[model samples]
Target: MATPGTAKRMWALDSPTFTVDKSLLLLGASGECTIPMPAFLIEHPKGLVLFDTGLVPAAATDPEGVYGPLAEHLGLSFLPEQTVDAQLEALGYKLSDIKYVIASHTHFDHTGGLYLFPDAQFYVGEGDMRFGFWPDPAGAGFFRQADIEPLRGRNVLEVPGVDHDVFGDGSVVILFTPGHTPGELSLLVRLPGRNFILTGDTVHLRDALTTIAPMPHDADTVQSLRSIRRLNLLRDSADATIWISHDPEDWAEFKHAPNCFE
Candidate 1:
């Protein structure tokens, strides 16, 4: 179901993560201190597609307000130098050229740079958007109103449930993988030479995939595990490489900055 004359390419941008102190409640049973955070860019003939927007460059200097909590949690002093715009520009593309912006979920980190593509159509799970706007009290601060307010009426594609072929061709598909966030979603891309499944927080680290470690916090533990299983099955069946959005090791393995996979 892939379209003709179109090539799919993937780019892994800067990678960053937050480490939880043992004093702070342990996340998984193993109680690992570090977690991986990554962002991706998808290149196609039609236009460029960005998976989850990493931290905004501005957050590095100020590290207060909305990012204050995140900064504290991460125990980092400065943010990474590679902003989404800079990374894309290095690859010979501009923010305006990105026609579609698909977010795995509406968490602040994932949606931070969404404002850069205000004109592009955003694809998100229908339930996720609703839950983001009215998240549970405990999860309210995770969704930033400023980041998502601009996308209200423009081209917002909301998928109800199940995996959706966004382009009606198998070239791009948005798969519903909830758990980390209420309406979390992942993408399955059929590239020319290879295939990839962008596992947006469905399975954070390689350990999670192999040992079934629990994420720090999840909307539903059972749903998250089920989603991970589904992704594993799809990856094995399609022979597609699974890219976890927040895996530093995986990010280091891919082409970075100007270089991309096509």
Candidate 2:
């Protein structure tokens, strides 16, 4: 094994913001909440890897252009500069530089930019891909046929129902975390000094971890709860920092782009 921290550098890309009823994210929660949509860029000795891709750049000017029928329901407010392409450019990198694109799931927001990295190797959960083909009606809106349609003829690796170590070095791993959808996956990054587990909507809010609150749209509430507990155990047993990718509070604290976590 290449020891921990085999990945050299990592950055959280800037992303557009979106608002939704708090109840949509957490069960029994009230009020509306605006949360940042973020994608992460990591540099491994192997090459550049992106965790998610945020929303489409065009969505900045036309939310409808991105969300279509779901635009108004989303209440998204995106800025031109918040696009992943722009943020990568600002950081002296470009979409083509990324060698690997790991989709947390087929959710439009998370895999929005997959088309940008056509040449890059793509990794996703088999279940998510299957869901894309046959989505649970409850979570159907979360998907965009266009988001995944582009994978056609491209090199894509569908991870099975277990954790996958991307580099075989114990540095960057893809955790099989489903339930939110049928195949939502999470990420694990091991730095020399510390480790991190980025929960990609495993539980949208940190509080859900303690509350054991459920997302009404989850395909399987029981499975979702199991996944949440799995995350908790992973965090404790691995002594890793758990980051809820969509939580507004998490967004505020994260060092975006020009700054990064090494």
| TM-score on alpha carbons, each prediction | 0.87, 0.95
lDDT of 2 by residue, 9-91 (tens): 77888777778888989999989899878998888889999998888778788888668867777778788888888888999
Listed per model in order, the count of residue pairs whose N, CA or C atoms clash below 3 Å is 2, 0
Instruction: Assess each prediction's global lDDT (C-alpha) against the native.
Output: 0.74, 0.85
Best by lDDT: 2
How many collisions between residues are there in candidate 2?
0
